[model samples]
Target: MSMFLITCSSSFAQKNELKELEKLVKRNNTTETAALLSTVEKMLPQATDDQKAAYYFFKTKNLINLANSGVDFNENRSKAIESINHLIKFENETKSKKYTTEVTALKNTLLAELVDEAIDSNRNKDYKKSSRLFEQAYNLNATDTVYLYYAASDAVNAKDFDYAESKFKDLIKLKYNGESQTYVATSQTTGKVESFGFDRKARDLAVKSGTHTKAETIFSKSAKPDIYNNLTHILLNKQNYSEAENYALTAYNLDKDNVNSLLNVLFLYYNTNRLDRFEEHAKKGIERFPQNEILLYNLAIINMQNNQNEQAKEYLSKILLLNKNHFDALKSLGNIELQKDADITNKINALPNTTTSNKKRNDLMQEKRLVYTTTLDYYKKAQAINPKDESLNELITQIQDFLKNN
Candidate 1:
């Protein structure tokens, strides 16, 4: 009987405090409400569901007010969101609508505030703060993955790469394409075309009202490729080659028509010594961009490295056809012709000191002369392309001496 009386007395006192708190909350008395909320928290364990509901509602309102007043704004905003979520969960489980409608509007207000601040932060180039705000916005509206993307992009600008990577991974997991459709129409009043971004209903209504004409829907490019490319770039910076290759390939496959995407994959494969893949893509790139100097030069170099002299010459010849002043191609052709001298010299040295051997040696010597002449011609062309290269002069003098002495 004594314990029951003590419990009843405590409950009665808690009920009186709740009434005072509700009054302070209703009056918009922030300071007193905050002070009273602290007291109410301790009494919460003994409070009934209705009392708890009222406390959550009041707490959310107070925190939002404090946030607006710039009193630990981020913390207060987060706390307010937490409180509202709790109220929503309770309302959901009990099949009650009390506070739900009001809290939803409050959430939208909070969202708008966060978005405006985030834009301001971005405009001020406070990238880290902007990233945080965008992340908060995303937490409020998880359906808007663009906010998450903005968060990741700002984190990148701030060089907060770890956070950027995590957010980018979240986008990939969500399969966020980030493609938006725009409804466009020529405004009848202004005689100009206008774009209604991702608001087809508004565009349709305007068209129906005869304020616009020639309605068309267009889609922006998907951001998935860029996301994969960014992930690959970060991984490459960390020298995690295997994982970088995975993401690079993903980007390449997703946007096969994009030459930049193909180049990114080609670059990774080339750097990783995946020559076969590089060659394959280089050929494809050449087919796509027949006049692409980089692809043509890369193919030439690849063929040269593999000792496919004829194929290398073919590619180098094409490069010269596109750009006759191609110094590297001209020098490369000279070097290829020069390499024949060593083999011919070896065969001449292997001959016996006899009549037949001398005749054969003379024939080989003539062949060597033809090779040197051809090499000199190419070297001269290269020198003409780069007249400032004194090394080319030295090479030309050496070849002249050899031809005169022989």
Candidate 2:
């Protein structure tokens, strides 16, 4: 009877249920596939926990198959998530090598699918959804610096800067000395083009190690301009203006034309109230880009602060010639004219008995009228360029009224 039963079981009609499931899944007959998977799940209680966990993994594979078939993917994803969680739980409870390995493989596969989904979401500009998927991928494999870096980038685009910073910190923390060089190379090759990956690593390590003094010594030995720029920014943020200035000067010496370092030096001077140094650097910036409207404007502001009205006017006139709609320069010119009018009014008041000066006052008034008319024309042109500036419109109205009344 035993021999006869073995022979009957060997026939194709009594084949293994799991093998039958494979055939059904291959045929894309989801209904039959689901039914077979459920039957296998039912057989788990009588089998070892490893067998039960293996059945759950098969269920996860079926879920992935459904996900790939373009049929109710959300439901398929949920099913896969549930099965993988159960597999993880069982493997942990039983400490079974077979179950653990299978679960790990399934987790990795799921994570890869999630990463692909994130790429699709990003392509569609669904950044929030993409970030969620990237977070899922990171949770599955925290050691994957590539995934972590991408997640951090997505967070940054979403304006979650704090979270992005934290993610970057996590990646940097993963670097052991032996692996640091490799990590730096991989970060450069695979990370965002604009990101400072290894420098970020070194910075975080320096902070955590509380050996920034040592790190600074080592960094100074190399004297990289980029490193100096980063350190300068940090020092500036900490309100260490002197140290910041030193770093900025060091970087400027390395690359004289570096805009960031130059700006940093100017900022240091401005914050430290070193007006002389500010003026010096402002002159240097102007000399470097003689035609730059911004540099010219900055020079005019410095002159204005020094009570050098004629010099300020000269720079302001140059700016207005280059950019006629320079609102700041126009306003400054108006203020200067008002100051001149105040001084002339004081002189006229002091000479009350000089009736012969009436002719001179009349000529001066005509000159003021011509200047006001020219200013009104400039304001009109500025209004045309920037219609959204209500202040400009108001100034135009005031000038028109003043011209009519005077």
Best by lDDT: 1
What is the alpha-carbon lDDT for the whole of candidate 1?
A: 0.87
Enumerate residue pairs that collide in model 1.
Answer: none
Model 2, range 1-406, lDDT digits (tens) per residue?
9987755654423237766776776677777888887777656545666556656766777887898787898678767777777778777788875657766887878887899999999899777667767866766665554566567667656766556546545554653111232112222233432322447676556446643322222221222455466557667877878757776897788777666677778778877889889879877886776667766776677667778889899988999889888877777776565556566556556665577988877777776667677777666665666778887778778778978998
Question: Could you give me the TM-score of model 2 versus the true structure?
Answer: 0.46
Q: Give candidate 1 misplaced runs (Cα > 4 Å).
A: 1-19, 22-31, 184-186, 191-197, 290-406
Per-residue CA lDDT of model 1 for 1-406, tens digit only, reads 9999988987888788878977887787889999988988888888777777777888999998888788998899888878877888898887767678988898899889889999999999999999999998888778889999999989999989889989999999999999998899999999999999889999999999999999999988999998888887777778788878888889989987776677777778877889888879887887888886666776777677778899889888999999998998888898888889999999998998888788899999999999989999999999988878887778889999999999
